[model samples]
Target: MKNRKPLVIGNLTARIPVIQGGMGVGISLSSLAGSVAACGGVGVISTAQIGWREADFCKNPLEANFRAMKKEILKARQISEGKGILGVNIMVATQHYKEYVKEAVKNGVDLIISGAGLPVDLPGLVQGSKTKIAPIISSLKSAKVLCKMWDRKYQTAPDLVVIEGPKAGGHLGFSREELETIDELGYDEVIRSVVKLVREYADKYKKKIPVAVAGGIFKSEDLDHALELGADGVQLGTRFVTTKECDASMEYKQSYLDARQEDVCIVQSPVGMPGRAIQNEFVQRVQREKLPIRRCHHCIVTCSPKEIPYCITDALVNAVEGNTKEGLLFCGANVWRCDRIETVAEIMEEFQ
Candidate 1:
């Protein structure tokens, strides 16, 4: 195939194999994602409460969310000069899950990467759109089941597969007990396992399924190591959070700057998934129950108001708004090393 020229694996086209990990709550918006895509990498916009600023969100969630999603995609596409691929990361647990994916497809999003849940119906959602669909998985078993199910039901395979290890930020893949038991565990084994399974499916279907690995990958060496170990590409999330182009507040960005190695700890999310985040006053307050879920945003579907300790949406929004004292700050394991803010070019240069 003559190397395939490193075109975008999903629906978009990029000059390089690097795919920007999607951040949310206005973090990886049009400005940041467009710039990265324009720079020759796949730029991803997070569809996580992206319409948060829309005045009609609270009153008319679906209409407002759809509108904002369309606007963001168009904005990102325009800013990228129509170069590179513009993709979206939509969590499966969010309210109106299929609606969000459909909205992205309707808006001409190039690709959709879903996580935080199985997203079993992902293929069905993008049935007629030209958008490519990829589900994020953590293990070989999960990948096999999803691919098998998609193949059987939709006669389609994942355009790409993202194997996120336990060290990733936000919602986690395993139980707290499991994550703790394997703390600091290298991802090579899991990556190889998932890649092996993906290869089997690829061979059977006579298609190429490029495997991308994530979680705790920070520097050029880390990327090189993954590539050497069979990863076709890499997904970097936490490292980009500190970039000046990131839409996060200065306080939030500074939190990463002030973080220590020990400060990055695994904590329980209000949605019941184990997550890695910076140990800050907000995290401590949640651990101590000093801060409570004052208002209900009804963001995630799996969360029960009584069982969940707090409303994740409100907490995260608070952090994006710069209320570090009581906000929820989600980050990957390498967040502690962020010491300063720089441009995406500088961040990407480090990997070069």
Candidate 2:
């Protein structure tokens, strides 16, 4: 692989094109994100039900979540010596979703990477803020939709686009049948297609929309291949979990260390989305029981807590709080490769 420096993504140049994948429900908070940014990569904090631990989280949702967002951003800024461009990953499906995006902007986030749903109106939410917006896309069609929506409505194109393949961690865009299809979609093919689409969109706008790819990327060869395919950068999430700077509990980290390739499976989430996760006892039980999940009228508007089988917020919080045995263990396909915990610097060195 050629030794090329990482490319920047937003209006302001990033020293490295690496974007820290946002993990949520307490994982990938300020400490981890700040460390990644300080090391010259784009650090990202996951805002998925982020304030589950606040004392008043149940009573005053906005106040608690807002406070957490501010605190975490402030903490990351301090750790980055005020130079790291801190970004937040906010799922468009969340309840009070717009509020979270607005709060992140109010707290001076450098960028917002939204996923889980098509954020057709995200550009409007970040109107005057310098916070760049990058929507996660699973296919070229999704990319086209997002670009068209943003251009027509907001008169602006996305600063960047993240092409997340099926092999990625957490939630996925494909269905169980699609994921289990006889012919699997090749990353190389997907990358080429998406890159071509992004380039075309960029040409029309007369601006470069930095293209980044994510999911199942773990080795130097993967990075090199992505760069060669026209992707300006890469986003990685699971690999960082094993890093020492990750804020997840030791047990949460250990789960990754102990995982085997077969342990990772695409389980059904109560939100009606398919997700990648370690097949632990919790997953087995959910599958076996087909639990009548009722969406707890708490987070994310699209979810009908009453009809959902489990509470996503509670499950993630349990894992973050160290109850991994009974909690949902979301992971990327390469999670099995983790064997030891190292610092962010050490992890980044491996890529270099």
Stretch of 10 with least lDDT, candidate 1 = 1-10
The TM-scores, one per candidate, come to 0.94, 0.95
lDDT of 2 by residue, 27-146 (tens): 899999999888777899988877777898878766888888888988998888765468999998888889888999998899999999899989999997888989998877788788
lDDT of 1 by residue, 1-352 (tens): 1132454474356665667888877778887888778777778999888878899777775677678888888888888898777899999999889888888888888889999988899999998779988899998789988998988998878888998888788778988887777744455777888888888878877778888788887876777777777878778888888887887888888888888889888888877788887788778877777446565555788888877777777778888878877778889888887877778777555554
- Output candidate 1 Cα RMSD: 2.6
lDDT of 1 at 183: 46
Error of 1 at 273 (Å): 0.6
What does the lDDT come to for candidate 2?
A: 0.83
Clashing pairs in 2: 94-300, 95-300, 293-308, 293-309, 294-305, 294-306, 294-308, 295-305, 295-306, 296-305
| The best candidate in terms of TM-score | 2
lDDT of 1 at 243: 83
Error of 1 at 234 (Å): 0.4
Error of 2 at 253 (Å): 0.6
CA RMSD per model (angstroms): 2.6, 1.9
